[model samples]
Target: MKLYQTYASPFPTRVRLLIYAKGLEVEIIEPPGFHASTEAKGDYLKINPIGRVPTLVLDDGRAIPESEVICEYLEDAFPEPSLRPADPWGRARMRLLSRMCDFYVVMAMVPLFNLSGRSRRHWTPEAIEAAAGKVAEALGWLEDYIGEDGFAVGGALSQADGAIVPQLVLAVEWIPSLFGTLDPLPRLPKLSAYWRAIQTDSICARLIGETRDAIAGVAAQAKAQAATSGG
Candidate 1:
């Protein structure tokens, strides 16, 4: 299988976490263009049509889009070393954490994109405050559900950890850099603890390092491009 992903994107990072945990033999590649506008055209759109990262193409030529759905497919296809809980309630808890990450947490981060990089010209106090507040609320919701044992759901790493890790990591850097706010994690104790504890897991540590490096790489490239263009 071929998985198209960009390391900086939280969505694809979640799927990559699962792939690493399961030791799946999937080829990872970047899409036609790493930018949104570039993704809307050409060969990549033909494959997934959504113009999104982390599209999984099976050997039979079937395409799967959306990170959460892709994670579910991988779990089903490769069940050993399962990332899901064994029981019903446990599975439900995992789903709940994933849902919060996707719906509430990711949604909160969306508005801040306008204020990102050279786009800070769009920043407004109201906009920044609103985004920060929304994310803080989302973090509180996560703290209520996240296990204190370092994993997001069960005693061990699960799909919930995959969902939580990348998004929270992005939130930690994005919010403070954009608005001079405190790192959001420290405000939520369970999540803050999980953030520190989960990194000790080898797969989580590697993926987190990749995500940070990719984000920094993108920022450096953007800065260099801006300098060249005299922006």
Candidate 2:
């Protein structure tokens, strides 16, 4: 099996977290025709018509899109080091957290993403404030649902951790840089504690480092592009 993904994206990063944590043998490759300059097209669209990152292609040639579905497929396909909780309610909790990351957390971050970095000048002060407010509301939801056990769903590392941690890293860096807002995670006690504790896990730490590095790389590229074009 192979996963077509980009390191810069949280959606793909979540799938990667599961791959790394489980020691899966799937090959990781960038989607064809996908880059800062271009969207996924041509060959990539043939494999997964959605033209999105983190598309898993099975050896039998079936394609899976969307991070949540991909993660569930991986967990089911490679069940040795199971990421799902053993109990029914625990599994439900795991799915709920993952869904929150999808529906609430990532959705809130969308506006900030639109207004981030060089795009800030294109947006008004009022627009930026509203975007930041939406982000804060989403963070509040996370604070309410998050467990005290350091993991998202259960006491151990599960699919929930894979789902949420990458987005948290993005929020930690972007909330302050883009919105001039304080680090909201630190203000939310449970989330702050969860963030601090999760980083101690080597896989989590590695993925976090990959995400930060990817963010930096993108920033540098943007700077270079802006300089070249005299923006």
Mind giving the per-residue lDDT tens digits that candidate 1 earns over 99-179?
999899989888775466545556777888888889899989999999988798778999898888888777887568747
Q: After best superposition, candidate 1 residue 129: deviation in angstroms?
A: 2.1
Please, what is the TM-score per model? 0.93, 0.92
Worst 10 contiguous positions by lDDT, candidate 1: 32-41
Screening candidate 2 with a backbone cut-off below 3 angstroms (N, C-alpha, C), the clashing residue pairs are none
TM-score of candidate 1 versus the correct structure, residues matched by position = 0.93
Q: Can you tell me which runs of candidate 1 are displaced by over 4 Å?
A: 35-41, 228-230
- Among the numbered candidates, top lDDT falls to 1
Local distance difference test values of all predictions, in order:
0.84, 0.81
lDDT of 2: 0.81
